[model samples]
Target: MVRALLSRARDMLDGIPHRWGSAAIASSSASGHGAEDAVAGYVRMLGAGVRPDAYTFPSLLKAVARGAAAAAEVGGAVHAHVVKFGMESSAHAASSLIVMYAAMGDAAAARALLEACPGATGGAPPPVMWNALISGHNRSGRFDLSCRSFADMVRAGAMATPVTYVSVISACGKGKDLLLGMQVHKRVVGCGMFPDLRVGNALVDMYAECGDMDAALVLFEGMLVRSMASWTSVISGLVRSGQVDRARELFDHMPERDTVAWTVMIDGYVRVGRFREALETFRRMQFCKARADEFTMVSVITACAQLGAQETGEWARIYMGRVGIKMDIFVGNVLIDMYSKCGSIERALDVFGDMHNKDKFTWTAIILGLAVNGRGKEAIDMFYRMLKASLIPDEVTFIGVLTACTHTGLVDKGREFFLCMTEVYNISPTVVHYGCLIDVLGRAGKLKEALHTIDEMPMRPNSTIWGTLLAACRVHGNSVIGELAAERLLELDPDNSTAYILLSNMYAKSNRWKDVQRIRQVIMEKGIKKEPGCSMIEMNGIIHEFLAADRSHPMSKEIYSKLETVLIDLWNAGYVPDVTEVFVEVTEEEKQKVLYWHSEKLAIAFALLTSESNVTIRIVKNLRMCLDCHNAIKLISKLYGRKVIVRDRTRFHHFRHGSCSCKDYW
Candidate 1:
């Protein structure tokens, strides 16, 4: 089969233009024919009494060099033929042979050919031949040899070409030898060969790889012409260097944007936690009608996950299908996560069910998703399903299992799983596992047991552990344990504003208004500011955000009016304001008003005004949804007959017919 293919390729090469012959050779050799078989076929051709010249050997060796390691070894057998044909002194043949050795990672053999070439008169190889050896060493990743070879060429009074500089500069990117790279740049300019587009690209890539974005940007600006490769290198380097702002700036200034550029910009924003900007960039990408690759959609969907933009994620899913981009395991997993985080567990389930390829990660993502969405039993069921699929559960899977028990207040089940993780699975518990167990005990009102578990921990407790205890303190109104938790938080992390905020929330829950005031004063004195509570809702492809008492939306009037009417109806339905959590130093009436204008309420009101009946209104909150907002949304869902899904900081609260999926346990 190899001989037949090679014979056909040789016959076709004889018929095509010489300029196209190398491409044909490459096309034929890529099929992975054995190196020994290729030589056997060639020898058969020669044995048939065909007279081959010096030029004939270059193309044949070119064919061998294009192949994999097995094919590259045939260079030796082909070299014997070249010697037989008395073409061993041919520079072209020698160059091709050098390339073949380098392709097989035989850098020393390639250099030996250069030194032994009869054409290297006066012990100085010409620039063309030197370039072959230099570039071949580079391809072999013997970059130091490439640089040394370039120096030898110059020292031997041989002129250097732009190709020489290009190859050497490329090696510096991997070697991280920025000084040698800059010296090459100086040499290139001195030779009046600077700014060759290929050399310039290599230089920019080198500097970027070496962590010198400033030099890269400076060189890029001075270039007479720039390609997308140039733009992408600098932008990518900037993103990795944590200067995504500069990357975005360069992205906006790009003369023409390609799919990679757009994707890079969106992902750069996502990496910097500027999720809104990423989504906005995706919007712009859609507006331009530029095509999106799988990578582009991955970044875009991740931004959706971060922002809880379900509608946008669904649109992306539809877009991918319309574009004939099939759902692979990776994309399937991302979609499941996006839906899960957006409080759309049913959609996540749909993605999980439709996926044909299920990796361990796929099962794990769905399990965690179910746990966070208040489907604890379902999550455990999925865990068993994963085990039945012959996939062993890892530590992450156990985290999901424990979290399932945590969200549903299954204290006994949580402890059992913790033990199972250590004994049955032989998975040593990390702090996270212990923290989950501690949270289980804490949530069950076993405050003393929770502390004892912390004391028994092999590792010192982290902020997350104390924070869990503090949160449980707030839940059960245990001022004594809450104080202990707060002191631990201060000792563990003096500057964390979360300790103060959680403390204040606990006091407010108990109607200790003066204590709340004191906590607020301390937070202000320490300049510790917790992020203000904010909620976001997506409707009609637009994401609307609101902060507490926010009136900044374009539909603020309608939202406020709708909220007022809804609250009035709720009050008629026997919904009294849960004023225990109202923290401001205000009168009773003012507190109720403030509660009415909470961020989630505004977002819900906006949805209530615009959405059709029966459409699920999804809201994402930056902080834990407040008590008043949760109770009011439950009533609003009942009063308006809408399914309301709100994903707060920790888990999903799905309100339907005046009940949350969490069953008041969260």
Candidate 2:
């Protein structure tokens, strides 16, 4: 249809009588790729002596802007002809030149054109010309200049039109200028443009993006009419302010929802760590038959990655393909991350290999994915490959590199990467980098070196840093430094349950019964509840969750019976239960029983009973794998000859043939 319209427009232009005032050459909106032909036809008409009028230059300039790199030269040529024709003083012609210059990002030329105006009409060259100036700058992301131009327009005794207010307010919103936005709001109201739908929406957006959610909500509520943009702006703003629940409430109340609206809610849930809710929202979107776009897919994929719900994520990927959503760079990057986090490293590699265009983020995602999946050497190799591809590593890329070295016991290599991050890349080391370095040193039993590194840090250590040191101390059984680390951690977070649990577990493993009892009593008195351990398995797009000794599944009877038989067979095969992992005051037999009913065991049992004999078993657990479960699963993998992948809080553990990919380090 667009081609037919362009053809018809050309035929009309060719029929012109080629005389002064015989016809005005006006092209339709010609401002996208390949409209240069229309501009050339207009030039032909001009040479044929169809004298141009005020309205002719605007269309000609609009048409010329479609010429790609040649637009600037053609626009200048057209401007010279407009001068020869004495249409330079026409407000339409001058504003068209401004628009043309602005489209070229020639801000100085655009300003020069604007300055040459106003003297012709005597006061700011009319509001339409000023509107063109401000809107051009706003479109160019020069929000500062847009606001300044709007202020100058007002000072020049020119009243802004609705178009002017909308562009300026949008500028204020995107520029994050709340004060100027409020002043613009007052002007909008004073000029009686507040009720205009476009102006009102711009005001709401201004308030929202400036982080004034209260004002945004109030203004939104008071609007007599609301569009999807109004609702989307407020909801996304609420999400930005960490009021995700309120944003969801407003989202629920929206009269209709589009893909962007649904995507904002899903992304909000993901940002707040509500992964289950995020996935559930995606399900609801599908149920409502709402269209999902790439943004929607990215949010859903991210939710699946966080939850380790590989099956659901795969469904999303397939759905995108069925729905004709292109596998662009963003979708590909996130897919690699999703598969990697879900312990599907082969799938991650496949996605990485399949991507035709790779950016810094694409390489970063795969590098981090490999690091977390216990493939440190491959991650390092990927990093060098990324550099070979001419991609400079960012802060996130370095984090993955440091993690790879830490897990692989390459302390010296980790230190080298850390130094390179500063000296070579000119990237300053953050606390996260420092913590990774400490973990590298601590895991290698260089406890004193880790402490000295901490002391030499440029900034104060946060709880995460202290916690990392304390964890290392527990691993090496250094009670004295462990005590100091624990004290520092406790001072940072008075009622931190993880710190208390780690200290108590360390004491229990060392047979310091008194210290364990003391920490346990303190935890009880403080009413600090430990995070209950849980594990999840995703099969056929349904996530099944299990807690310790859970009996809620329909297959509970068979699962428990299978687990019992499996444990017995492993025990007979020389699997001794590591009761030292039972971090509680219980009898020896009770601790062994408790270890048998752990959440991961139940998940494993369920997986075994429901899956095919040759199928790999994957589990995602919230907490770190305990010694008893880790040792038991290793033996289970070897005996059953099933590759089992478990993603715990810290990293991945790939168990096969009675050995772990972490090599017993993590």
Candidate 3:
């Protein structure tokens, strides 16, 4: 029906006189129906021998700008018409032409048209023309050109309007040019254009993005009225500045909450590792009846992954389906990561398989997940599959593959991949990759080789590298290399409590009581307190946390009683406390008591008391599991005939039938 109307209009234009023909074309173009139809109507008018006037070209150019497919061709024809009529000198026609070219991502053509303007003189072009150029450059992501144009506009004595300031400020923000942004703010104030809401909001956003939170806050508080975007900018900026508490305070004070505002707050909590708070905020958002979009859901999924809240993450996935939100590649990638992190590798694989498209991140997440779960061979197989599918392996992907080799004690495979990463892939090994290699060698009892690798690294070894070596040395009882690693680690990170603790543990194992005491004294003198070990478990949609020897939960009595029973079973299974694992100079019984109160054991005890028999017990801990805890958990798994999954800071341990998925290598 629209096509019929266009045809009839064209026929009417053919019969109309020249003077009315141009008006007819202008009216048709102004209808804003469709760019193609509008251009067709103009062609009909031109065929009828009508000449385009100054006013006629602008509307035609606007119509051409609206159509992206045939825009260049139609726009060029319109340009020819402007030149033929000698109306290219008209400011209205020239500005429209410039904007049209810019809309098509042709900044070069836009500049050419601007220079061809009859009014182009020694001075700066008109502010409107300059704004069009700046807007075009800014739209095309040529931010530097946009800024330079703004400067030239100023030098030509052309006063900038609110529109001009908006584009320039946006360019400044995108370029991270705080100085230019501040100057733009000053110009806005001097012109009294700060009263403009758009100008005000842009200034605030610019300041915030440029890391000038103080300036951003000042402008934000001074605004007469605030939009959702205005509040979100400040809140997100505060979050980026690591002021999460301040961001939350502002979030609470918001008069109204939009999805973006809610997303910002939830994501802010996630950024600070406050997964519980992030989940709580997400729940509150749902209760408030605000619908979550893909961005919000992704953040919520990440929070769930961090907390191992598989139930919540599953619900979020269902919610997305219920709301008819299509899972794009980005959402799919995050889902893979979320499921993998939540200790459900099968579900993660399902998500990966279901994805219609997979990027490097998707592949990396799955491989890393499998590696951390101690499915090292599967991870390496996936890497080969990724290559077969023609996906380029990035630095992160190699890390996963190398980590797999480390977990599985495939030292030769680890070395092969390490060399391949640098030679075949031309990807330089980062400290993390080097650390993984060292871990592989060190865990295999190749202390000398590991030390040599560190010494041969292209970059200086970081604390993580030294820390990995020290951990391996402690595990294998290599006191000589362990001491050297400890010294180097301390020099790099003077207050690293983990290094001190590991070194002290190694000393204690070798009966170096005096050295252990001296290290303890240093720790005390430096006020370097160790992070208290804590473990978390999720049940019935609630997270329960337990610290060492904690008795805070209402069911603490039952948990401890269950722990006693598990300890008896462990003893029957040939379990004995490795007192040497304890770093302190204490009696053997004291060390045994200390091992009995580990946070992970307490968490498992609570799980055994509360969880159903057939279900897996999943626990997340903040620190590495001690050898005693590792041995006990393995025995508990066998005695109870239940599977237990424990994720420490470094890797996951799956215990079943008196064996670990890591094969006692980790």
Candidate 4:
């Protein structure tokens, strides 16, 4: 019965085209399920004296590409059979060898096969053979050779197809060779392949990756037949180039949305802190019944974290479980961030502990979550565990560890980690790395050391680095560093309004009325205006965006009335306005008015009027929460008996029962 069944199966398979049979085998191998079994079956077929032909080679080559441990042996047997059949010099067999070796990540073998193929020594190889070789080099990460191969093929008068241009465009993106990519674009147009969607999509992606949005847009507009990939590449390119509005427009016009499209748009909106749009798009995706893949889930989790959506985040966690997708390291990391941002450090720890295979990203996410949550000691402990697990610390990992130290006023520990990051890991500090250390020292009131750090940096200090020092000056009330830091910040960012605002605020705090007026004169002269700080809070699945003191909402009256009640209670509890934070040439009454309309306060008021009494209120801010807002929110949490989670530009602030996760550092 088994013999009869085998015969019948073979007969059925024989009735299919060889290309179809090859595709089936390749798909199975690519899926990683059929590697060893396929190899053994191929060996058994050989033992049965089945005469394998060219059609059989792609399947065997596919198995070799799958990187099974026995690839070399299986491929060698196939090569030997080709030689025995006197087909070694055949273009078909040689191309197969090149593809097989490339898949094996053995670029050397692929090159040898190309050189030895008939007519390859002097005359041009067939385009098929050239494509196979170039593709192999590309997959093997030998982009230089891939590009060289494409050029050589074209120079030899081989016809360039859309696939050829796509491959070359991909190589250009990898090498960041913008000039060469432009040459490829010219050649693509010269060859009358200008409107090919695949080529157009590849060109758009290449340009986008190189930060050339204009070029990408030009190609995108010229394409006649746009597929989902074409739309996504352009949309994502726009987002990456900071043309968020254009990206959103394109997204709204896409005929159909795929998981990539949904995830990319959500990621763009979340990156710019447009939480309401991110959540609404996510809802639209759900309504369209698009299954959230892991990437999509990760993007949405990040958005939720930014908005401090504890209930929504937990609901997403349950939804992920229902979808039967196992939580991988990326998903686990995002979950940790979400829970920590939602004021549930215990849940963050649970996700960290349950992760099956934790990578550096996984470690960094959990550690950063703990650090941002003000559990600095636990974050430091986790760093040690990561070292014990033999995961080398990268620049980002140290940032988390050092930030934890900064938050807890662990000056000594922060210094040790900073030194060890350079000495032990041999990882040179970047500008960002220096910025973190400056923040650490400045936060500890080590103004002198922070100044020294600024001087010692190899690269010119950016406005952000100087801004850190200035911020520390504000906290420590150090006039000297504040002046010098402000000068440095202005020099670095001449048009930056934030630095001027900070400087003016420092001058006002010191009662320097002349300096404040002078700063205001400069701001007026330069026509520089401060962007109003705004915060958004999501309530009942609708996002409520508020500008500082905004009274434009439908429930503005009630929100302001609630704000008045909170302000009365906060004042009775000894809350005083940090009048200097207004940082402008305004009357005291005007300054207080400005403070009252600050975005976070407005968001808080809105949350109070609209949300359930005991429910946690989540707010997201575009910048760091100001001192007054932070202090006021703490009091409001206690007065209202509510938890308020706020996500600022850099990290999360979980305020509950009058305490914050950052323990006031953030």
Candidate 5:
């Protein structure tokens, strides 16, 4: 029966005139399997000697516009045919050809066609023709030209339609020109063309992209009709504005949700450092049977990276393969980052090796992963390898390389790369780069050079640079430089409780009790509360959080009991509590008690108690690990013959056999 229908279709095609065949091609291009297939059928009709007409070229051009990469050569061929038939002057054919050339990424050809329109001399082309030109430029990413064409159209007395405003407003958003966007919005309102679904949605996106969320929200609420695109735009804008809770509310109220909406929400959560919530929303998306795409998976993987949810991250990577999702560069890079952040550097390397294509981001992720995992030499080698491949290093690439140098105490290499960045690569060092260099000098105990580097910085140092220097001072017991760094940091960020606390601790270490008391009083006067220390551990796809002296966990008793046992072994291994690192005015015993209940210690205790022996224990801490806890963990690892990996606020520490990867430098 299918063969009979096919035969009849061919018979009809053989008898149809060129005009009828053109109409059939248009119909097929709009509703058939795809434009390429329809175009192929049209070519078959040509092979059967059906004479091409003026109507025939437009349909062929339309097919070229619909077909993406495969249509470029076909479009050129059609343009040649139009020239041969003298049909290029036909307004419809010219406009269709312009759109086709633009869709094929040939902006030059599209412009030439626009200029060749029949009304090109004194009068402007038709509005439809101008709209095609504007849209073509927009598609080619020449937004500036797109906006210029809009002005040209207006000056030529061409009537702008809702479609024109939509394209122009989108260009405004891309260029981040809120002023021009508002001008366009005014025009839209003045023409009584406001509130068109497409136009209104573009306006919302423009306002949102320009950081005017209030205006976006107002417009969104006033719109009588909203599409899924509108909701997604507003939701993403709200997320970018740091209103995650409001974004979530809107997302929950969305009448319909698509894959893009789900991905936006998940990405929003990840952006705000709410990884667990991101994962929860992802699970809900799966429960609702919303098919996850590449974007959704990238967001989910990023959330796992931040949370150090290695098990779930690995499962996501495996699931991508099982579901036949192509491991594109984006997914591949994030996977490397996820495994690296989860302390699985080997797995990160594996992913890196498996990627078929590697961009700068791909190299940067793996380099940073190796750097953070304390494989600094390997990171440096990878940077050279990237250079050998003729890939120019960007700012982020330098950051990873500088960080690797700092981690490995390669001071000379760090200096060379620092100079090479500005002198050879011509990449101006951002404050972050300076911070990394400061950390390198500070770690190497070159306190004077670190301070000098700050003085010689081309730009004013930020709070992070000063804070990094102060941290190094605290680490090396250089109270003089520590005092200077603290003062500068406080001046820059007056309400920074970490600076106050660190300054007070430095003073206490030298028995300068009065100075310590003054800082504490200042903290109280300013109401600057210190951020509570927190530590987290992931087990069996669940993350457990603990705070200093926390007893909220269901297994608190067992955790505390295990902590006590570990303390005994640590003491037996000759571990001494570094009371000087504690800033409290209490007695030494009380100081020891305070130190024992640190959040990371509690997390480690819980992990040791619950997990099987011989497995590496991983802990993530929100604050820098205390000296006493660091020493205790080192001893505990030696005593129990276990390896403990801790990711503190600044860097990673792998403790084994009474030694730390940081070599007591951090």
Candidate 6:
């Protein structure tokens, strides 16, 4: 089959115009043939006496470079043939070798070919060849080589154009080399390469990636020619560098936003957990008739999951069905994530089951949803099923299984999966992986094990791992580990009020009143303030935000009054203020009164008062719910017979029938 295809390709190549012969070669080589078969077929062409010329090397090398498992080995043979044919010195042949080697991930060989070709001038490689080489290096994580090669192009007096500059700048982005990137920016201006859209886009991307939004905006504003890519690069960069407000401004200002621009803005909102804005932008994208690609679908699905927008997510599913998009691994994974987060794990399982093809990410997504959403036993079973199907679990898959173990308090199962990740899969644990493990141990009241896990981590622990331990300490009443975790968290992020609050709670829980007072004193001395917890719920397409003790709503008086009634009812039902959280010089009654206005409780009451009877209330919170608030939500869910979904900073809480979706673990 391969020889026949190659023979047909060679016969067709003979009839193509000389200028289009290279394209024809690339086209034929990319026709889904195996590299080994392509190689065998090419040799057969030579044996049949089809006198291979300069064009032949380009075609044959391309086939071998991308076709077979042994891409580089086969590519080297093609190079030898070119050299033997006395075409090695030809500029076309040399350029093809340069690109072929680079594409085959052998940059050294590409450089050697460039050095050996006498016909190769300083810029003889051409921009196409240079772009290929630089992009290849970037893909291979050889940022230094890419940067050095760009410099060599300039020092050798090669005319470096904007296309080439984009490749070089992107390479710097891969390296995260801010200083080197800035130096490249200087070279761009000094070499009179400004005003080029591609170069300007690269500059915007570089600065945004390096956390220099000021420079990124400056470049964006000064660009004489800005394409959609130029605008999207800056907008997306701002979003990624934690400047979401600036990103929104640019997104709103774009006179014409393509699908990429809209998707990126939605992604920015999703990243910051602002799903309402993401949904709004998605609606606007549809209004503008911009096409929703796979990425747009993913972002919208993520927003639906966070907001529990069943109607919107179902609409997306219907749209995807109508369009007949392939639902490839990424789309499938996100769909599963959406269904899982939206309190529809059955839908998540259905999507998972319907997938004709599955990759590691797909498995991980479904497993994670089940594990974290009160299906710990099912998560474990599905993981075993994955192994039965001979699918290997990567590090990400382990996190899901570990989360399942944590939620179910399956200490032994968690340890087994943790070992499987390192021993069976040979996958080294990342900080996220460690964080999940620590959470599992901490939740199980294995404080010693959680602490030991942090100490045994190969790399220095990040705030996330320590934060997990701190949260677990709160649950398990381990003051020592809680204090240690808080201290470490403060060292990593000094202004993190969550750490300070958690430490204060730890002290108060252990009856260390002086310590709690000292913590408040320290907070005052440092001029740091705890950001009030806020939750938002969407009703009739309008979002309402509620803060702790917030009285800013138009119906504030009514809302507060209704909240007081709920507090009175809960108080009669044996609810008590977990007074440790008050952290104020106030009377006991004042503290109890203050607890009634807690963000989640207020939001729940407001949602109940506004929405129709029996409607579910979905609220997104910026911080964790306190113990008292969690219990109150449980009782409210049952009393009102409403399903309340609150997505706090750490995880989701689904309250109904006097129970939570987290199974009382979170």
Q: Across residues 238-267, which tens digit of lDDT does each residue of candidate 5 receive? A: 999999999999999999999999999999
Q: Taking the tens digit of each residue's C-alpha lDDT, what string does model 4 give over 206-287?
A: 8987888888888778777889988898888788788889999999899999889999998899888786678788898999
Task: Please identify which of the two predictions, 1 or 3, would achieve the higher lDDT against the true structure.
Answer: 3
CA shift of 348, model 1, Å: 1.2
Would you estimate the TM-scores of all the predictions?
A: 0.71, 0.82, 0.79, 0.76, 0.82, 0.69
Ten residues in a row with the worst lDDT in model 6? 15-24
Report the lDDT of model 3 for residue 448.
99
CA lDDT of every candidate = 0.82, 0.84, 0.83, 0.78, 0.84, 0.77
Error of 2 at 552 (Å): 3.4
How high a TM-score does candidate 1 get?
A: 0.71
Per-residue error (Å), model 3, residue 535: 0.5
Task: Give the C-alpha lDDT of model 3.
Answer: 0.83
What are the runs in model 6 whose C-alpha is more than 4 Å off?
Answer: 1-224, 240-255, 271-275, 306-311, 319-326, 386-394, 430-432, 451-530, 555-558, 564-580, 612-614, 661-665
TM-score of 5: 0.82
Error of 2 at 480 (Å): 3.7
Can you give the lDDT of residue 311 in candidate 1? 83
Candidate 6 lDDT tens digits, 375-430:
88999998988888778988778888988888888989888888878898999888
Better of 1 and 3 by TM-score: 3
What candidate 3 gets wrong by more than 4 Å, as runs, is 1-142, 149-161, 384-393, 419-427, 493-495, 504-529, 584-587
Per-prediction backbone clash count: 0, 0, 0, 5, 0, 2
| Model 4 stretches astray by more than 4 angstroms | 1-105, 112-130, 151-162, 178-226, 247-257, 261-275, 290-292, 309-315, 324-329, 337-344, 491-530, 571-578, 583-593, 612-614, 649-652, 659-666
TM-score of 3: 0.79
Candidate 1 residues 56-137, lDDT tens each?
Answer: 8777776676555544424555665566567767878878878777756777677777766554455666787788887777
